[model samples]
Target: MAEEKKEFWRWTESNWKSPDINWNDAKYMTVGIDVGSVSSQAVIMADGKVMAYGNMRTGSDSPNSARNALKFALEAIGDMPEDRMDYCIGTGYGRVNVPFADRSITEIACHARGANFIYGPQVRTVLDVGGQDIKAIQCDEKGKVTNFLMNDKCAAGTGRGMEVFSDLLGVPIQEVGDRSFEFKGEEPAAVSSTCVVYAKSEATGLLRKGWTKEEVLAAYCKAMAERIYSLVERVGVKAEFAVTGGMAKNRGVMDRVMPFVGLERMKTEWDTQIAGAAGAALFGFALCKKGKGRKK
Candidate 1:
């Protein structure tokens, strides 16, 4: 918790790598700011190294969240020469509200760009399961978004859903994976409800039925798995996949996704988090490579 919180404050690495920015070729490095529904993130690429990067919680103010996320990145750079900053790119729901951003991009493009950059050129698909949204994107070899799909209208199978379930079982979000891992027998919870509000109601019933916490968690995993597969299936279920965003941190979901997709085509590495941040940082490098400039 403390380490995650520190990202919002600034760069703290004792040993920082120099980004491979050609001083003669370009000016300032590029910045990527992702202001998500529940959290905000920033990344800076200078020279050949990721100069500074950080993420902070997004409170009620979306605009400030975007600005603060960028500021946090600067803090991480720890006296990084300000003159080197050449361009700024913003994304996520709050992108349009980031006053300091030179240009705002759609979250879909941002996620796709971010994912392709982190996972490498061969990444064919990305399951960006965010806090309040679910975005599935396909990308080309150059890290450009090809075809994508998203769902933001509801709250089923998202980070928010997990938080609610965590509270119902009296478990912290961090403890869910370990607790679920401890169970011996299979006891699934009844989560027939899709809407978040209704899911809460159903979770309460499962609690009343004396379902062990692990069983309930497992059931919830499959339930969310159901929703996630719907999106993955839409992208036509391809190989070389990646999953990004905050919820990508959930071990249970990570444990469940590849099996549902099948190990033969899945290629193993499914459970992940912060792939979005990695992607954002990679895009920052891209913009720098292109000698990009932006205003307004």
Candidate 2:
């Protein structure tokens, strides 16, 4: 048999529930489903705080992805029935495809709101780098978006772009961050192209010329940082900034971009990938408070 190639770009999936929270005691239960191009997240909130959440890879069928994410989350609360949710909101690239959602909100708004919740009310700026796009958003104390800019036209500077390099370099996606700092001497200059196709070719040539894999990884990270910084510049950065999405977990890119932006990222105990879904859940909570919950 031919040797099986290891998949280096896959990230770990997870689900969790707050140990102290008992869903049966909650007066209101809400759910938010965020189905993106690369991943799907489901967040269940009891009253206004998170009770359980699930993070998983997005499937080809968006509705199925949404259902699976919810099921995964519900697994954390074994006896909770799906019908107990008072309201449901959907967000992200596949927001419209969430069949059970009472309403759909834009990821931009959801992210801003979620950032406020995760990073605290002090967060006024949020940079979300997802699978296929980047978003820079500025919001007020209440998490209302004031201004935002998104680069969805290309895959450069996003998770997908990093995945391509991970495969090309034969590095595990999780190890790319730590390994990038292993090269000797000063950091190398960034790769020339922001376009993934052209950049891949450039990396191949650099390897042929004897550039080490770590050096190439560092260069690509620098390139990714520069590209991301450029987009954040257009919308402007504010103090108490926070980063969300998959890229927030990648130190190779985050470390490179932070110095350029000149702001320390706000700390959050919650998973960054769940921001959009958490925000959606929060929105559902607000609607429920307004007596707008789904009618039986």
Candidate 3:
């Protein structure tokens, strides 16, 4: 039999519910759905506290992705009925496609709000390196966005760009971070091209010139770091910097970018990928408190 091809770009999917929180006793039950380009997340909050969440790969149909994400979260709370949810807010690239949402908020605002909740009130700067774009946001203690800049025109420095490299190198997405640090000697110069297609060509040339896979990976990560740093610079870095989205988990990029940005990332126990959805849930909760709920 021919050797099976491994999917190097695939990432893990998961769902979780808080064991300590009893949704039945909560005064408000809110839901947030974030259907992004590469992934979809659904978060359930009870009285402003996260009760359950699900993260999964986005499928071809965005509406189905949103529903599937919500179904995954509901699995953790077996008895929770969808109709019992007081409010549901949608946010992300496919926000308008969330059929069940009462309102749609921009991912930029949601990310800032979610970062404030995850990293605490002190978080001032949020850098979200997502699949198709990079967002650098400045916010106040309450999670309200003060200023922000986003780079959506290109895949450079984004998760999708990294996935292309992962496939090109035949390296599993999860291993890219550790393997990137395995290169011998000094770090190689970053790949020169900001365009993914040109960068792939540049990498191919480097490999032909005797560069190891590890070295090439390191160089690509370095390039990603520099590109991300440039985006963050436009919004102005602040103390208590926080990173959200999938890229925050990759030490390859985070390790290289932190020193350049000159700040320690704020710590959070929650999954970084759920930030946008979590923020949406929190927004729903606030609206519920103000007598705003799902439209009849």
* Model 3: per-residue Cα lDDT over 153-201, one tens digit each: 8889999888889999999998999999998899999999867899999
The TM-score that candidate 2 achieves is: 0.98
Could you give the candidate ranking by TM-score, starting with the highest?
2, 3, 1
Better of 1 and 3 by TM-score: 3
Off by over 4 Å in 2: none
Cα lDDT, model 1, residue 50: 54
For all candidates, what are the clash counts? 12, 0, 0
TM for every model, in the order presented, reads 0.83, 0.98, 0.98
State the local distance difference test value for candidate 1: 0.68
Question: Which consecutive 10 residues in model 1 have the weakest lDDT in total?
Answer: 6-15
- lDDT value, residue 293 of candidate 1: 56
| Candidate 1 lDDT tens digits, 191-220 | 787667877787777868887778777778
